[model samples]
Target chain A: MKLTILGCYSATPRTLNNTTSQVLEINNHMFLIDCGEGTQVQLRKHKIKFNRIKHIFISHLHGDHFFGLVGLISTFRLLTREADLHIYGPKGIKEVVTLQMKLADSWTNYKLIFHELTSENSELIFEDDLVEVHTIPLNHRVYTNGFLFKEKEGDRKLDINAVEAANINIAYYTKLKQGFNVKNNDGVLIDNKKVTTPANKPKSYAFCSDTMYKEDIVPIIKNVDVLYHESTFLEKHAHLGPKTKHSTAKEAAKIARLANTGTLLLGHYSTRYDGLKAFKEEAQEVFNNVELSEDGKTFEFN
Target chain B: MKLTILGCYSATPRTLNNTTSQVLEINNHMFLIDCGEGTQVQLRKHKIKFNRIKHIFISHLHGDHFFGLVGLISTFRLLTREADLHIYGPKGIKEVVTLQMKLADSWTNYKLIFHELTSENSELIFEDDLVEVHTIPLNHRVYTNGFLFKEKEGDRKLDINAVEAANINIAYYTKLKQGFNVKNNDGVLIDNKKVTTPANKPKSYAFCSDTMYKEDIVPIIKNVDVLYHESTFLEKHAHLGPKTKHSTAKEAAKIARLANTGTLLLGHYSTRYDGLKAFKEEAQEVFNNVELSEDGKTFEFN
Candidate 1:
């Protein structure tokens, strides 16, 4: 899986720093997360293909989180996009987006499907043969949710030399990959594990932003390959985190440490701070593995 | 008068080119016109003082014209702006803007005044001692209007030497500036023209965009010092102009010629062409004094 950070700064979008937006490419799916203002321009600047995005996930109704949504929809209409677009967001997202379309009188030619999410518990939002997505309820000033994307376990891999030595027919290969015992060409029962080996371990990623310090979320994102958490403040301004319902660098690292994530990625920095060095240093004090997310940066997990 | 072109492209914003938005500074007032997406960032890139803008004029409800308005408003609230902001646009603008604010649960601490216009005739919408603004109704796919900004006549410049030679009292300077005949210290009636000359001719500017080749608006914007009109296509693609409710460069210059404008400014070029050379050459064919409006270019009129 590869993740590209289109924007990572918090609050206002500046010339050098952008707001929250990321593109996650996993299992042939490109998912857009938390499109802030100027996200479309950032996407163009980064040379991301607009048509590849089929699903968009929004965290909340904050202006900094989803203000670019209407513009992107309209641009899609202008470009005459024919594919269906799915949007997953808070309950009020549909009303806000549809109202703008109604006023402009420029309805999209393509199908626009809205999945309004209102559940406060962790539940499966999307699932397919290869991947599953679940919602992680977050504590913020508004109704918000973080998404957890996990790759499903794959079928076992066949050892060709071992299968041939066992006189297993090609027709039984499918059954063997499914971990089932089957009769070989010699009419003898064969064990599934003797001819096949288990597939590689699946990888998972969790994205959380604009939330306060909540210890209950550690279980939902436990043992993920990568975890991206918002750290809107550093230790110097840690006092301002609770009032704004935002988390500090130390708080995000504490959650990552409890969850045992392989890598902890920090983002959504407030513009008041001059540099991002303090955040990484502060987060490293709590978690052993830490990474800082910047605009136009990319991370790959194998 | 100074006009800064923040963005002047026709449709969707690109990596380098932007959509429609401009800043007009006349007689100490900063007016924002047609805020497209990414306008807030453009404003920051240009280093414009955000607090100086008190009024915003939107041409219509098209996404390319006004999609960035809600984001700018939210930014103002984030900056804790206490000044009143006045917005003038179509009848449905209030509902569209307020709905987004309601969903986000973010209201401005400053007063937001909306002047919803539904008139089809040219009418005076704003007036003060220094400047007067009028609407020039234009023909388009949607209800639209072009703005006309005219600087009001200023106080007459006193010929200081001539006033002293005429023996006019200093107490009567205000009357003399108002073009009134005042008695001198010797109680002699003095002629107004002998002591003071007329103020510099009041300058005017008209902005017309996203309209077809309609000649009816020529009378409303006639004799303006500067005229900025949309030229979305060239003569090669003039056939597509009427269907899209856009105009060609040659067609815009024809209106400038008929209206006797001082300088015809061409903008809102479609992204199909590479350079702006064709637009300027085509517009210059019909009008002697023509200027091309480019992004980040400023035009000053004295």
Candidate 2:
């Protein structure tokens, strides 16, 4: 899995920095998260294929989180994209986007499906044969949700030499891969473990942003391979976190420590801070594995 | 008068190219016209002061023209701007903008005044002591209007040496500057022309964009100091101009010639073209003074 940080700043977009937006590639799916203003330009700058974005997930209705959505949709129409696009966001997202399109008198030739989310509890939102996505209800000033993408466990790998030694027929090979004991041609029952080995462990990623320090989410995102949490403030400005319903670096680190995530990625930084080193330092004091997210940066997980 | 091109491309913004937007500075007011997406970042990249932009004029409801408006307004609120902001656009602009703010529950602390335009005829929209703005209704797929910014004629410049030589009383200086004959200290009627000369000729700039080859606006923007007209295509694709409600470089130059504009500035070029030199060459064929507008390019009119 590969994740690209299209933008990581908060509130406003600057010349050198952008607001909240990211692209995650998992199991052949490119999911766009929180498309802030100027996200299309950032995608182009990062050389990401625009047509590859099939699903878009918006955390909330903030301008910094989803202002770029309508423009990106119009661009898709301009490019004559025929692929059906799915958008998962707050309940008001559909009205906001369709109104703009109605005013412009420009409608997409392709199917534009909207999955409006209004639930206050964690629930499964999307699932396929290879992956599953669930909503992680977050505490914020507005109705917001973080997403957790997890890869489903795969079928067992077949050992060709062991299968041949066991005299397993081609029809029984499928059963062996499914970890089922099957009868061979000689009417002898063969154990599936002798002919096949277990597949590699699946990986999971959780994205959380624009939220306050809520301990409830820690249980939901526990033991994820990677966790991207918003750290909009430092320890000095920790008081503003609760007031704004945002998280400080230390608070995000505490959540990371509680969840026991493999990696804690910090992003959505407030522009008031001069550098990102302080956030990493503060997060590292509590969580040993921490990384900082910047615009145009990419991270890969095996 | 100075006009800065914040974005010049049409349809969509690219990694290096931007969409339709410009900053026209006349007298002491800085007028922002057609705020496309990424305009705030472009404003910062060009080092334009945000507070100086008190008024924003959107050409139409198209995404390329006004998608960045909400984000810009939100940024102003985030910056805690106290100045009142005036937005002039189509009739549906207020509803579109206010709905987003209402959904996000992020209303601006500063006053946000909307001047929605529904008229198809040319009309005066803004006026001050030194500058006056009028709308030049253009023919397009949607209701659209181009803006004409004219510097009001200033007070006559008093020839200090000539006034001193005439022994004119300081009290009568204001009357002389107002081009009125006033009595001197010796009770002699002094001619105003003898003490003061006429002020520099008023400079005007007309912005026309996203329109077809319509000549109705020629009378409204006639003989302006500078004229920025959209040239979305070249002569080879001239047939597509009218169909798309756009204009070719030759058509823009023809309008420039017919209106007798001082300098013809061509912008809003389609991304299909390779370079801007072809547009300049094509426009120069019909008009003597023609220049292509590029992102970050600025034009100063004397």
Candidate 3:
């Protein structure tokens, strides 16, 4: 899985910075998450194949998180997209987008589907053969849900010596790799694990933004390959953090530590600060594998 | 009056260009006209006082014309704006904006007033002492209205020399400037016109965008100072002009000539064209004074 940070600044889009938006490429699916204002332009600058983004996951209704959605949808129509586009966001998203379409009188030629998320519990929103998406309920100013993209686990390993001894037929190789024992013409069983090698391990990515520091999500995202949580402020403003329901760098690190995720990606810095190194230093105090998510930056799970 | 063109391009906001948006500053009132996406960033780039923009006029509901409105409203609230903000647009605009606010659960502290326009006839939508705003009924794919910002005939010019010749007392001079004749103590009637040379002729700016070349509006914008009309395509594609409910440069200039306006400002160019000189050239074919609107450019109506 690969992740690209399209924009990650707190508050509103400024002359020099953008709001929240990111792209996650998992199992060949380019999923856009949290589109803010100017996100379409960012998509163009990043050279991401926007047409490939069939699904969009919006965490909440914060302007910074999803203000750019309407523009992006309009642009897609203008670009003459033919593929069915799916949007999974908080409730009322359908009204906002459909109203704009109704006002413009420029509806799309392709199917425009809206999956308004009103559920408070974790549920599957999208799934394919290789990947599955689940909502991670979060505590925020509005009904919010973080997303978890997990790759389906593959078959177990095989033993080459056992396969040769059992004289497993080449036609049953696939079945053996799928962990199914095959019976040869000699009436001998060839154990699946003894004939096939294990498939590549699956990876997971969890995204949480504009939410308070909630540990209830730890179990859902525990041991995930990559966990990106918003760090809107620093510990110095910890008191203000609670008032705004935003987390500090230290607070994000605490959650990452609790979840024991492979890596922690922190972003969504407040516009008040010019530099973001302080956040890195603060988060590093608790989690060693914490990385800062910069605009236009990309990360790949190893 | 000062005018700033934040995004003068037609259609969608591209990677390198934006859509329609402008700011007409009249009598210290910052009036935002047509907010396209990335308009807030442009507002910041031009150092515009976002808080001072109490009134926003949207020509229509096309994404290119008003997609940025919600973001702007959200930004204003995030900035803690206390002043009441007024939005004037087609009917159903209030529903679109307020619903987003409701979903975000971030209502503004400032009073947000919406003036939904549905009239097909010309009428005054906004009026103050120094400036008056009138709707210029437009023909488009959707119900649209053009806005005309005419500087109320300059607060009756003093005409000091004329006042002195008429022996009009300073106190009565105020009455003369108000277009009223006053009788002096000697029972002499001081003609208001004789005391105050016709106050500086009001300079009116008519904005007609996304409209067909309809000459019926000539009488409405007759003899205005400046006219900003949409010239989406050059005469080369003039065949599609009327069908699409759009105007060509030549057509726009024809309106300016028939209206006998002082200047014709051509904008909303189609992205298909690489240059704007053709638009100006086409307009000049009908009217002598024609200018092209460029993004980030300003036209000071001194």
Candidate 4:
């Protein structure tokens, strides 16, 4: 799995910093999250293929989070895209986007599908053979959600020497890989565990942003391989977190500690902060495995 | 009058080129014209004071022409701007902008006034003591209008020596500046022309964009100090100009020549072209006084 931070700063875009947006490549799919203004330029600057973004997930309707979506969609149409694009966001997203297209009198030649998410409970939003995505309800000034992406476990690996020693026929090899014992050519039952081993463990990633520090999400994101949470403020401005429905670096670290995620990635720093090093320093006090996200930064997870 | 080209390219904004947007400074008023995507960043890059832009004129509802407007307005709110902003555009602009703000639950503290234009004929849209802004109707796929900004004639220069030689009273100096012949203290008429020369010929600037080659606007923008017209393509792609309702550089030059504009500024070049030199070269074939606009380029008119 690979993750690229196109923009991580919060509120408004600046000459040197951008608002919220990122690209995640997992299970052969590229997912765009929270396309803030100027996301397309950032994508081009980072050399990310525009058509590779098949699915877009928006956290909220805030301009800093989703204002770039319409422009990106329009650019895709101007490029004469043929692939189907899916957008998953809150209920009002479809109306807002379609209205703009209607006014401009320009419609996408490709299939534009909207999956409006209204459920507050944790529910599966997207699933395929390789991956599954679920929503984590978040607390914010507006309707918002965090998405969790998990890769499905693959079939067990086959041990060629063990299978040949067991005299397992080619037809029974399929069953063995499925972790099932099958009858061999001599009518003797063969042990599947002796011939095959378990596949590699699946990895999962959770993205949360623009939400206050809430412990309830811990259960939903527990034990994820990587967790990205917004740290809009530092400990010095911890008092403003609750009022603004945003999280402090210390609060995000506490959530990371409670969820026990393998790695904690912090992003969406408010522009009021001078530098990002303070966020990492504050988060590290509570969570040892903490990393800071910067524009154009990339991370690879194995 | 001063004109600054924030972004002059057409279709889509790229890392190297931006879409249509400019700032015209006339009579102490900074008027923003056609704010395309990424305009705020462009403004920052150009170091334009945010508060200086009090009026925004959008030619049409196309994404490339006005997508950056909402983001700019939202940024103003974030900055706690107290000055009222006036936006002049097509009829649907207010609904489009207000809807986004409603969805985000973010309302501006400053008053945002919208002047929706629906007329197909040239009409005065804005006017104050120092300046008058009139819409120059244009032919395009969508309802569009080009703006003509005229600096109202200023008070005639006080020719202090001439006024003293005429023995005009201090109280009558104001009458001389207002182009009125006043009675001297000795009861003799003093000619105003002898005391003050005519004010610098009121400079006018016309902005025409996203329109096909149409001659009807000639009378409206005639004799303007500078004319900024969209030339999305060169003469080589003249066939595409009519179909797209855009003008070729040669066609823009034709308009400039017919309107007898002081200087013709060609902009909104299509990204397909290799460089901008071709646009100027093509336009200069028909018009002698021609200028090519680049991002951050400025033109001063006296």
Candidate 5:
């Protein structure tokens, strides 16, 4: 799995800083998250194929989170894209996007599927054969939801020499990989585990942003391979976190520690801070593994 | 009058190329024209003060023309702006913008006044003491209007020597400047023209974009000091101009020549061309004075 950070700044977009937007590539699917203003330009700058994005997940209705959505959809139409696009966001997203299209009288030729979320509980939002996505309800000034992407377990690996020694037929190889017992060339039943090993552990990634320090979310995101939590402020500005419903670096670290994620990625920094080193330093004090997210940076997980 | 081209390229915004958006500074007022996506970032890059922009003029409801408007307004709210902002655009502009605000649940603290236009003919839309703005109807695939910004004639120049020699009262100077005959201290009525000359011929500027070669607009924008017309295609791609409802460089120059504009500024170039020299060459063939607009370029009209 590879994740690219298109933008990571909080509040308004500046010349050098952009608002929240990221591209997560998992299980051969590219998912766009939180398309802030200027996101399409950032995508172009990053050289990400526009057509690779088939699903878009928005955290909230805030301008900084989803303002670039309509522009991107319009651009797709201008490019004459034929692929179906799915958008998962807050309840009001469909109305806002369709209204803009209606006003401009420029409707997209492709199918635009909107999955408006109103559920306050953790529920499965999207699922396929290889991966499944669930919503992590977040506490913010408005109705917001973070997404959790998890790869499903794959087929078991075949012990070729052991299978050959067992006189397993080529046709039975498929059944062995599926962890099922099959008859060998001698018409005798053979145990699947004797010739096949279990599949590699599935990897998971959780993305949470624009939320206050909520301890209840730890169980929902427990033991994920990677956890990206918003660190909009430093420890010095801890007082403003609750007031603004944002999380400080220390608060994000606490959540990361409780969730026991393999890697804790920090992002959505407030532009008021001069450098990002302080956030990493503050987060490291609590969590053993911490990484800072910068615009245009990419992270890979195996 | 000063005009700054933030982004002048046609169609979707790319890495180095931007969509249509510019800033026109006339008579001490900073008027923003056609805020395409990423305009707020462009404004910040150009170091233009955000609060100085009290008025925004949108040519049409196309995504490239006004996609950045909602984000800019939301940024104003985040900045705690209290000034009134006036937007003049097509009739459906209000519905589109207001619906986005409703979805985000983020309303601006400042007053947002909308002036919807539905007229197919040229009409006056905005007027102040120093400047007046009118709509210049153009032919396009959508209901589009170009903007005509003209500086209102100022008070006649004060000839201090002539006024003192005529024994005119200082209080009557206001009346003389207003082209009214004023009585002097000797009780003799003085002719206004004898003491004051006409205000330096009111400078005018016309901006037309995303329109085909339409000759009817010549009368409305005739004799303007500077005319910025859309040149979305060059002569080589002239066949695409009529089909796309866009003007070519040669076609733009034809309109400029017919209108007798002092300087024809060509912009909104299609990204297919590698360089703008071809556009200037083609335009100068028809009109003597033609200037190509580039992103971040500024033009000062004196």
Candidate 6:
């Protein structure tokens, strides 16, 4: 899986910075997270194919988080896109979007589906044979939820040479891939582990933004290969409670440490702070594998 | 009167171009013409003081023209703006804007007043002592109206030297400024023109966009100092008649010429045509004083 950061600033979009947005490419599927304003322009600047974006997941209804959704949809229509677009967001997204379309008198020719989320528990929002998406309830100013994308464990790979040496029949190859000992035509016993190897390993990514430091999300995002979390404040503003619904760099690292995540990507920085080196220094005190998220930056995950 | 082009392109925002939105400075008040996507960012890029924007006038509800209204409104709330915001647009604008605010649970702290336009004829939308705003009925896919911002005829200028020469009393100064002749203590008749020059020669600016060439608007915007007309295409695509509810550059110029506007500013270009010079060339054929608008460009009418 490859992750690209389209924007990571907090609140406003400046000339040199942007708001929250990211792209996750997993199992040949593209998913957009938190499409802030000017995301399309950032996508174009990063050379990301606009048509490849299929699934859009919004964290909340905040202007900075999802205001660009309408423009992106309209742009898709203007470009005459025929591919169906699926948006998973909080409730009321459809009404706002459809109302704009009704006023403009221009509706999309392709299928436009909105999956509104009002659930408070971690539930499967989307699932295919290869990938599953679950919501990670977060504490924020509004009804917000983070997403956990996990890849299913792959089937066991068959060792053709070992199977042949064991005299396993061709028809028994399927059983071997399923990690089952197979009986050949000669009625000989075959060990499953001797003739089979492990298949591709599963990977998981978690996305969280505009949320306070909450311990509950640790269980939901535990052991994630990568975690993209918001760090809106610094330790100097620790007096601002989690009720403010904003986390500092140290708080984000604490969550990553508790979750035992492989890597932590921090963003959603308040514009007040100019340098990001402080964030790294603060986060490194708790989590060793921490990195800053930059616009148009991409990451590779195994 | 001053007009600032925050964004002038049409169709969709690209990495290098943006949709429709402009800032009109009239009678010392900042009025937002349209709120396209990325308008706040454009406002920032132009170094415009966001708080100065007190009123917003939307010509129509096309996504390209008004999609950014919600974001701009939300941004004001986030910035803790206390000034009341007044919005005037077609029917349903209030519903759409308030709906988003309700969903996000982030309504503005300041008063947000909505004035829905339902009239088919011209009506005064806003009026102060110095400025008056009227609707210039337009023909489009939806109920639309262009805006006419006219500086109310100023109080007659008191030609100071002429007033003294006429022995005009100081009490008659206010009357002379109002363009009225008043008697002095000496019973001398002071001509209004003799007392004052012109009260700044009330300037007028008309903004018409996303409409076909309709002769009906000529009388409403006649002799306006500056007229911004939407030109989505060049003469080559003029075959798409008023049915499409759009005008070519030449068609826009024809309306400007018919209205006898001081200068014609053409914009809202279709992305299909890469070169913008064609629009100027096509418009110059009909109107002698034609200007091309681009993002971040400003026009000062003096």
Please compute DockQ, using alpha carbons, for every candidate against the native two-chain complex: 0.79, 0.93, 0.71, 0.82, 0.81, 0.73
The better-scoring model by TM-score among 2 and 3 is: 2
- Judging by TM-score, tell me the better candidate of 1 and 6: 1
Error of 5 at A91 (Å): 1.3
Instruction: Give candidate 1's total backbone clashes.
Output: 0
Q: Which candidate would rank higher by DockQ, 3 or 6? A: 6
User: Residue A122 CA error for candidate 1 (Å)?
Assistant: 1.7
lDDT of 2: 0.93
The regions of model 1 sitting more than 4 angstroms off are none
Estimate, for each residue in B1-302, the C-alpha lDDT of model 3 and write its tens digit.
77888988887887778899999887778899999999999999999998889999999999899989999999998889999999999998999998888888889989999999999999999998888999999999999999988877664667788777766677786677778888866769977766566666666788898899898888899998899999999989999887889999999999999999888999998999988999999899899998889988999876
Mind sharing the TM-score for model 2?
0.99
Query: In TM-score terms, which candidate is top?
Result: 2
lDDT per residue for candidate 1 within B218-285, as digits (tens), equals 99999999999999999999999989999999999999999999999999999999999999999998
Q: What are the models' TM-scores?
A: 0.98, 0.99, 0.92, 0.98, 0.96, 0.94
lDDT of 1: 0.92
For model 1, what is the alpha-carbon lDDT of residue A51?
A: 97
Expressed as tens digits, the lDDT of each residue in A20-129 for candidate 4 is: 99999998989999999999999999999999999999999999999899999999999999999999999999999999999899989999999999998988989999
Model 5 lDDT, residue A288, Cα = 79
| Residue B117 of model 1, lDDT score | 89
**Between which residue pairs do clashes occur in model 1?**
none
Q: Which residue segments of model 4 deviate by more than 4 Å?
A: A164-167, A170-173, A183-188
Deviation from native of the Cα of residue A167 in model 2, angstroms:
2.1
Interface RMSD of each: 1.1, 0.6, 0.9, 0.6, 1.0, 1.0
Per-chain TM-score, chain A, candidate 6: 0.96
How far in Å is the alpha carbon of B295 misplaced in model 1? 0.9
Query: What is the fnat of candidate 5?
Result: 0.83
